[model samples]
Target: MTEFMFSLSALCRDSRARRGLAAVLLGCVGLVLPLAAAQAERIKDLASFTGVRENQLIGYGLVVGLDGSGDQVRQTPFTQQSLTNMLSQLGVTVPQGTNMQVKNVAAVMVTTRLPAFAQPGQSLDVVVSSMGNAKSLRGGTLLMTPLKGANGQVYALAQGNLLVGGAGASQGGASVQVNQLNGGIVPDGAIVERGVPTTYAQNGMVRLELNTNDFAVAQNVVSALNRRFGGQTATALNGRTIELRAPTDPQGQLAFLSQVENLNVTLPPARARVVINARTGSVVMNRTVMIDEAAIAYGNLSVTISPQQQVSQPTTPFGGGQTVVTNNTQIEMRSDNGSLKRVSTSANLADVVRALNALGATPQDLLSILQNLKSAGALRADLEVI
Candidate 1:
C-alpha cells in the first residue's frame, strides 16, 4: 500500500511539471506574436486616395533688384522685351527704338504645387529658377507672376523677396560658389486665386491606389479594413486598386477616412530587386535579394607611353649640315592577372553582402559581375540600371 501511494505522488508531480512547461511556451508565443504585429504599417503610408493629389503650376516672371547680376540685354533679348512690355503697361513707355540696358533685372520661371482642396487666399511656397544668363538671383524680388495649371488657367499669384541659399564672390578672374545660385525659394509667397475641385467620396464610395502594384498588399488592406469596419466595407478591385464603401455626408466621410488610414496592416515581403546607378557606380539591393553560387574574375589593363626627343648636329664645327630633331616613343602595356573566386550561395541579405565583399572588387567592376551573374541565372532578383 505504501509503494502504491509513492507511485501516485510521483505521477502527480510529473503532470504538474508538464503543465508548467506548456504555460511557459504559451507565454513566449504570446510575446512573439505581438512583436510581429507591431511591425505592421499604417494604410496611409502604403496607398493614397484617388483624386487627392497635388497639381503642378508653372509661370514665367522676372526677378528684379539684383546688384549687376541680371541678364544681359544684348545676349537675352527676351529680358529686354519683357522689361519694355512691363514699362508700357505701367504708363512709363520709353520712346520707340530706345535701348534700355537694365543691369538689375533677371527673367525667371516660377513653379509651385497646388494641393488638393486648396482654398482661395491660401498661401503656398514657390520656386524661382533663372531662365536666362544671370550670374545670380540673390537679393532679388520676384515680380507679380500668375501661376497657371496644365489647363492654361491661372491658379495663383506669386510675388515675394527671393530667399537664395547660396553665396558667390568673383575677383581677378577667380570665382568661388556654394550650393546653387541660379534658383531660390519664397516661403508663403503665393496666394491661391482659384481652388481646385476634388471628389473625395464619389457615389458613397472611395478608392485607394497603392504606390506599388502588389496584389497581396491590396488584399491585406481590404482584409484589415473589413475586419475593422464590416465585411462589405472594403473590396479589392484589382492588384493596385481597392474600393471602400464610405459615408455620403462630408463630415462622416472625413472621419471614416481618417480612421481607415490609421488602421495598421501587416505587409507581405517585398520583391527582390537591385538598383544600379551607371553614372555614379552605386549598387543598392533590398533585403529579399538572394544569390546562387557563382564564379567571378576581373582584371585591370594599363598602358604607358614615353617619348624621348633627340637632336643631331654636325660633329665638327662649321660643317655644312643642318641640325635635325628626331622623336622616339616607347609604349608599354601591362595586365594584372585575375584569379577566379567562388561565391557561395546566400539566403539572407547579410550573407549576400559578405560574399560580395569577399571578391575584393571595386563598385565599377562589381557592376559587370552582377550583370553577368544575372545572365547566368545565379542572381535571383530584377536588375535595374539607372
Candidate 2:
C-alpha cells in the first residue's frame, strides 16, 4: 500500500512539472496565460469614443399601481395638479377647489440614454425616479411619458411596468425599507420617436479615440490598423485620438473598421498610480506603484479631560459652620510609541502595504502618512485624493 501511495505522488508531481514547462514555453512566445495566472489588467475593460456618446433625455411622468405606497396628495401638490390635468384631457370635469387625496399616484421624472445611431421605433431602457414626496415605488407602473432632450424635442415615449429593486412594509406608523425608495427601471420601455441624424459610414474620414492618453499605445494602434488594412490608412493625431480614412463603399468601411477594433495589440507599461479617498479613508495602489527608500516616524498624542463633582451636607443647618465642597478635575495625556522605519519599495505593491502596516497605523492615519510620503518625494506615483 505504501509503494502504491508513493507512485501516485510521483505521478502528480510529474503532471505539475509538465504543465509548468508548457506554461513557460507559451509565455516565452509572447502568449499570455489565463487570467488566473496572468498579471493585473492595465487597459480599460470598455473604451468609449470621445465624441461618440449618448444623449440624455428627460421627461415628467407619473407612476401608478402602487400598493398604497405612493405619494401623499397633501404633501405633493404637483401630483394632484398633474392628475387633474390628465383627467381633464379625458373629458372628466373636475370642479375647481376640489380636494384630491390620492394615494395610488406618484409624480416621477423619467430619464433615458439615447445611444448613438438609435433609429425611430427602436426600444431603449428608461429609468423612473420619484420627484415627489413618495414613500415607495415598488410594484408600480409608469404612464406613457414623452421624453425630450435638451433641445426641447421629443425623442422617445416611455411606458411600462416598473421594476423597483426594493421592498417596504408599514404597520401602525412603523415601517421598514430594504433598498432605495425612489427609483426604478424598465427594460425596453421607451420607443424612439426621433433620431439625431449624423453621417458615420459615408464620411471622408473616421476618428478613433483611445480611452487613455498614451502616445505609445496610440502609435501602436495606428500601426496595427495600417498594417491590417493598407499603408497610410490611419494616422495618430494625438495621444488620445487617431484619424483614419474610410473606403467609399459603406459596407467595406464597416467591415474594415470592425476588424481594426478587434485586433489584439499589447498594451504599453502603465504608469504608477495611487488613489486615495479621503472621505472613506481608502487608499488603493496599483501594481506599478513604486517608492524610493525613505524613513517615516509619525506618532499621535491624545488628551482627555474628565471632571467630577462632590456634594457636602451643611452642619446643623448652617449653625455658624458651613461645609465646603470642591470640584475634582483630571487631565490625561498619551502618545503612541513609533520608531523611524526605513521602507524601500519598487514596482511591488505588496511590499508597500507591508511597510505601511508595520507602523501600526489605522486607516485614517494611513492617509496622512501617504500624503506626507508623497510630499517628501519618496512616493514615485501619482497621488490623487478624492
Candidate 3:
C-alpha cells in the first residue's frame, strides 16, 4: 500500500508538469504567428480588377506646316498618296500626270490611350510619330483624324498643335540635333466620341487578380476580406485570383469595392531567387537566398602579342641604298596564382555578397563561378540567366 501511494503521487506531479510545459509552448506559438503575418499591403496596391484596363487608339494622319524638312515625295510614294487624298477631301483637285515637289507635309501615325470608364467628350493626350524621312516636326499641326478601336468603330477624334521638345539646324551639309524630332505629344488633343461596352458590376461576385501569382497571398486576401466583412463573403479561386460576393446595384458595388481596396492585407514572404543577366554581366539576388559551405579557386590566363618595328640606315648618308625597316613580333603570357579557399554557408544576402566579393574577380568571372556552383549542387536557389 505504501509503494502504491508513492507511485501515484509521482504520477500526479508529472501530469501537472507536462500541462505547464504545453501551456508555455502554446504561448510562444501565439506570439510568433502574428509576427509572421504582420507584413501586409493594401488591396489596391497588390491587385487590379478585370475589365478596368486601358484601350489603345491609333489612326493615320497628316502633319503639315514643316519648313522645307518633310518627306521627299519620290522616295515615299505612300506619303504622296496620303497627301493627295487629304487635299481631295478638302475640295482641291490634283491634275493627273503632274509631279508635285512639296516639302511642307509629312505622313504620321497618331496614337493615344482611352482609359476605362471614360465617358463622351473627355479629353486624352495623343502622340504623333512620323512614318517617313521627315527632317523635323517642330511646327507641325495634326489634322482631324478619327481614332478607331479593334471593332472598326471610331472612339475618339484627335487634332491639335504638336508639342515638339526638340530642335535641329543644318548648314553647308552639316547638321546637329537634340532629343527626338520625329515624335511629339499633344496634351488633351483627343475627344472621346464613344465608350466601350463593359460587363463589370454585372454579376453579384467580383474577382481580384494579383500582379504576382502566390497562393499564400490569395488565401490571406480572402481571410482579410472575410474578417472585415463577414463569413462566406470572400473565397480563394486559385493561386492568382480571389472571388468575393458584392452588392447587386452599381452604386453600392462601387462603394463596397472602394472599401475593399482601402483595406490592408498581409503579404507572404518572397521565395529564394537569383537573377543573372548574361549579356551585361549583372547579378541580382533576393534576401532569402543562401549558400552551402564550399571551396572555390578562380584565376585568369592571358597572352599578349605585339609587333616591334626597327629602322636601320647605313653610316654613309649617300651610300645607303634606302632606309629599311624591320618588323619583329613579340609574345608574352601570364597566369594568376590560383589558390583554394574554404567558405562557410551564408545565412543572408549580405553574407553571400561579402563572400562573393572576397574573390576579387570581374563580373564575367563571377558569372562562371555562380554557374559552376549551381551545376555542382551548391546553390540553394533557382539560377536564372537572362
Candidate 4:
C-alpha cells in the first residue's frame, strides 16, 4: 500500500530520503509519509477550468406502490392536491365532495447532478426524498418526473424503482428501524432530454486557477511552464492564478495540455502549521513545525460523584407506620503528582510525538500541553483550532 500510494514521492525524493509533514490519521497515530517534492502534483489534479462545471437539477414528483406506508393525506393537504391534479390530467375525476384516502402514495422530490459536456439521451443517477410525513419509502416506485435546472427548463426525465437501504416494523406501539427510510436513490434513472452548452477559453491564452492559494507554488508553476515552453509563454497574475499562452487550434491545445500536466518541479517548504480538531482530539503538523527548549510539568485531576438512595421505616406502636426516603451522596477526588521535564527542539514529527507520549498524556491532556507550549512561545507553528 505504501509503495502504491507514495511511488511518486520516492521518485521525487533527493539522494537521501527525509520525512515530510505528518497528517494525523487513525486518531492520534500519525500518517507519516514521505512527501519528497510536494510540488510534483499534476496540473490536472491541481487546477480546473474557469467556466466548466456541474449543474444541479431538481423536480417535484410522486412515489407509489408502497405497502401502507405512505403519507397521511389529511395532515399533508398538498399531497392530496397534487394527486388530484394528476388524476384530473389523466381524465379520472372524482365526484364532488368525495373523501380521498391515499395509503400507497407519497409526495417526493427528485434531484440529480447534470455533469458538464453531458449529451442528450445520457442517463444520470437520481435521488428521491419524501417531502411529506411518510413512515418509510421502502418498496416504492418513483413516477415519471421532469428535472429542471436553475433556468426552469426541463433537462431530464426520471422514472425508476427506489433502492431503499432501510427497513422498519411497528406493532403495539413498539417500533424498530435501521438506516434511513425517508430517502432512496435510483441509479441511471434520469435520461437527459436537453443538454447545457459549455465553451472553454481556448483562444491564444487561458488562465490557470490553482487548487490551493500559495504564492510560492504559483510562482514555481509559472517558472516550470516558462522553462518547458518558452520564457514569454507563462506569467503569474497573482498568488493563486497563472496565465499561459496556448496553441489556437484544438488539437495543438490538447497536446499542449497533456505535456504540461505531468512536469514536476521542486516546491518551497510548506508553512509551519498545526491543525487541531478540538472535538475529535486529532493534531496534524507540517515538517516545518518546531519547538524551543522548555520545561513542562504535567498531571491529571479527576472528580467522581455517586448517589445512593435508602428507604427508612418508622414504627409508631400500632398507631401508624410510614416509610420515608433518604439520600446519600459521595464525592471523591484524585490527583497525580507533577514533575518538571525539559523538552528540546524536534527536527521531525516523530520526535515531537515521542516526547509527548513520554508524559503518559491522554488526548485531553495533549490539548492542554500544546496550548501551554503555544502560550510560552515554545511551539513554533500556527495553532489552528478546528
Candidate 5:
C-alpha cells in the first residue's frame, strides 16, 4: 500500500485511542465553560450558624500608674473607693473617717470578646474604658480583673499595660488633645479561663446557615455543595439554611467543615437601600434604587432681628440716662436667591448627586428633599434616616 493508505489503516486499527482523545477534549471544554461563568467569593464572606455568635465580656477594673492624669477625686468617688480597697488588700489600714486622695488611679471598665471555641489559656485583646470622670487614661496600667459575660460567668482574666492610641497635655487652663482620652486597647491582655461548649458535628447531620436570607442564594449554595459531594449528601432546608449528611466520624466531619468553609460562593445582590445621615450630610444608595419622574426645588431664607436700647439725656447722654430712655428695633430679611430649578434624578447614584448639587442646596436641604421624595413615592428604595 502507499504511505497514505498505510496511515489510514493504522488509524482504523486504533479506534479506541481516537475515542479517548475526543472524550478528553470534551471534558476540557466543560471545565473551561464553568470556570468562565463561576464567580469567586472570599472565604470569610460566607456561611454562619444561626446561634453561633461572639460573647461580650465586661468587668470593673482599676487603672493605675498614670502620670497625674487620672480621675478627679471629688468628681469620681469610685476612684477613691477602688484605691482604698486596693490598699486594704495590700495589708494597709487607714484610720476611720480619714480622707485619702489618690492622683494616679482611675476606675475603668474592661471589655473583651470571648471568641467562639476559645479554650483555656488563649489570650485575647481587651478594651479599657474610663467609667469614672477620668481626664485621661494615658500611661496607665490595668490591674488584673475578671471579665464576666451577660450570664454572670467569669470567662477571662485581663491584666496588662494599656496601649492608648491617644495623647493629651494640659498645662495651665489650655489643653490639646487627639483621639479619645478615655479608651485604650491592650493586645493579648486577657487569658481565657474557660471554654464555651459549641457543637459542630452532631446527630449525623451538619447544618450550614447563610449570613443573609435569600432563596436564590440558598439554592446556589446547595447546588455547590451537592456538586462537590454528590446530590444525595446535601439538601437545602429553606432560604437560610442547608443540611448535609455528616461523615461517619465527627473528626472527619470537622475536616469536612474545614473544606466546606473554604468553598467559594457568589453572593446574591443585596436589597435596595438608601442610607441618609442628616448630621454628617452623607447619602448612600444601592444600585437597585430607582427614581420616578419628579420635580424638586430648594431655597434658603435668612432673617436678621436686632434690637437696640437708646438712652437720651438732654446733651448729657453719657452723664445721665434717667432723663429719657427709648428702645429701638430693626429687622432685615434676605432670601438666598430663591430661584426654583427643576431637578430630575435617575437610578444612577452620580446622576442623583449631580441633580441635587445643581440647585446649590446645602446638605440639610438635601436631606429634606430626600425625605419629601421618599414620602411622595418617587424614591424607589428603602429610605433609612440616621
Candidate 6:
C-alpha cells in the first residue's frame, strides 16, 4: 500500500507542473495581445473607399432684409442687377433706367457640400458669403438660390433666414464688431433636388485609396484584409490604391466591406518630415525627424530712428526773426554678436528640438536655419514650406 501511495504522489506532482506551465503561457499571451492591439489602427481611419466623397456645390444668390448695411448700389452694380432680375421674375416690373438705390439687398454666393450617397429631399447646411461690398449680412434672409455642381446641373435649392454668428454697432464714425459679418451659415437651409450616382464597388471589386502614399502601409493593409477574409482577397495596385474583392450582391457587399474596414492594420513608421508655415512662422516636425552634426550661427540687427520737433525763437525778443519750427532726428543702430554653436547629431525629435532651442532663435529665425540646414544636407528629412 505504501508503494502505491508514492506512485500516486508522483503523478500529482506532474499534473501540477503541467497546470503551472499552462498558466505561464496564458500570462505571456495576455501581455503580448495588448501590445499588438495597441499598435494597430482601424482601416477606415487610414483609407477611404473610392467614389465616396463630397461634391462641392456653388450658386449666386442675394441676401435681403438687412438693416441698411447692405451693398452700395453704385459701388456694386451686380447687387442692383440681381435685385432687379429677381423682382422681374416675381412679376414686379420696374421701369427701364430707373435708378433703384436699395440699401436692404446684397448679392451673395452660396456654397455647400453634397455628401456622398445623398438622396432627394435631404436637407443640407449652406454657407452664404457676400460677393459684393456688403457692410453686414446680419438679420438677412437668403433668397431662393439654386446650388449647382461642377457639371452645371442644379442639385439643390437654398432659401432660409441667415444665422449670422456676429453682431456690430456703428455710430459717430466709431464701430465695434465681433466675429464675421459678411459670412453666415443656414442650418438645413438647402433641400436636395437631385442625387449624384455613386458606385463604390464595380465588377465585384472595391478600390481603397489611402490618405497618404506609402508602399509599406499599402502592403500591410493588403495583408490584414487577406488574413481576415481569405487569400487573394486584397491586392495592392500601388502605394496609394488597393483593390479589394467584395461580394456581388449589394447587401452582401456592404456587409463584407464593413467587416474589412473594421479590421485592424498595423501601420509602418511615418516618413521623417518638417513642415514650415512661412506666413505664420510655424515650424512642425514629426517624431521621426533627425538631424546631422552641424554648426549654426545667427544674429539680429535692429535700427531705431527718433525725431524731435522744437520751436526756435530769436535770441532777442522779436529781433526781426519770427518763431521758427525746427526738427532734429537721431538714428541708432544695434547688432547682436553672433556666435558659432555646434549642434550634435540628433536621433529623435526631442534631441533635435533641444539642439535647435539652444541657439535661442525665434521661430522666424528658426525657419531660415532649418532651410539652410536642409540645403546643407544636415537635416535628414524633407522640408516643406507652406
Each model's total of backbone clashes: 0, 0, 1, 0, 0, 0
- Compute each candidate's TM-score over C-alphas: 0.85, 0.79, 0.75, 0.76, 0.80, 0.86
Q: By the lDDT metric, which is better: model 3 or model 6? A: 6
- For model 3, residues 1-386, the per-residue Cα lDDT tens digits are 00101244555579786687678669878966886676667999999876678899999998989988888999888888888888899999898776788899888999999999899999999999999999898898998989998777899999999999998898999999999999999899999999976655547988888899999988898899999999898888889888879999889898999999999998776788889999999999987788787778877999999999999888797785888899999999999888787666887676688878776768898799888888888888899999
What TM-score number comes out for model 4? 0.76
The total number of steric clashes, by the backbone 3 Å criterion, in model 4 comes to 0
For candidate 5, the per-residue lDDT at 96 reads: 74
Q: Which digits, one per residue and each the tens of the lDDT, describe model 5 over residues 39-127?
A: 55743376775445689999999999987778888888877878788789889987777666777889999998998889999999999
The 10-residue segment of model 4 with minimum total lDDT is 19-28
Per-residue lDDT for 226-272 in model 4, tens only? 88998678788898878879899889987887787777756788788
| Candidate 1 structure lDDT | 0.90
Better of 1 and 2 by TM-score: 1
Weakest 10 consecutive residues of candidate 1 by summed lDDT: 1-10
Give lDDT tens digits, candidate 2, residues 129-181: 99988888888999999999999999999999999888878889998989997
Per residue, candidate 1 scores C-alpha lDDT tens digits across 43-113 of 99999999999999999999999999999999999999999998888999788888889989999999999
Worst 10 residues of 3 by lDDT: 1-10
For model 4, the superposed segments whose C-alpha errors exceed 4 Å read 1-34, 37-39, 69-81, 94-104, 130-135, 166-178, 305-341
* Cα lDDT for residue 195, candidate 3: 91
lDDT per residue, candidate 6, 165-195, as tens digits? Answer: 9988989999999999999999999999999
Off by over 4 Å in 3: 1-38, 167-177, 279-282, 295-343, 361-367
lDDT of 4: 0.83
Alpha carbon lDDT of each predicted model = 0.90, 0.80, 0.86, 0.83, 0.79, 0.91
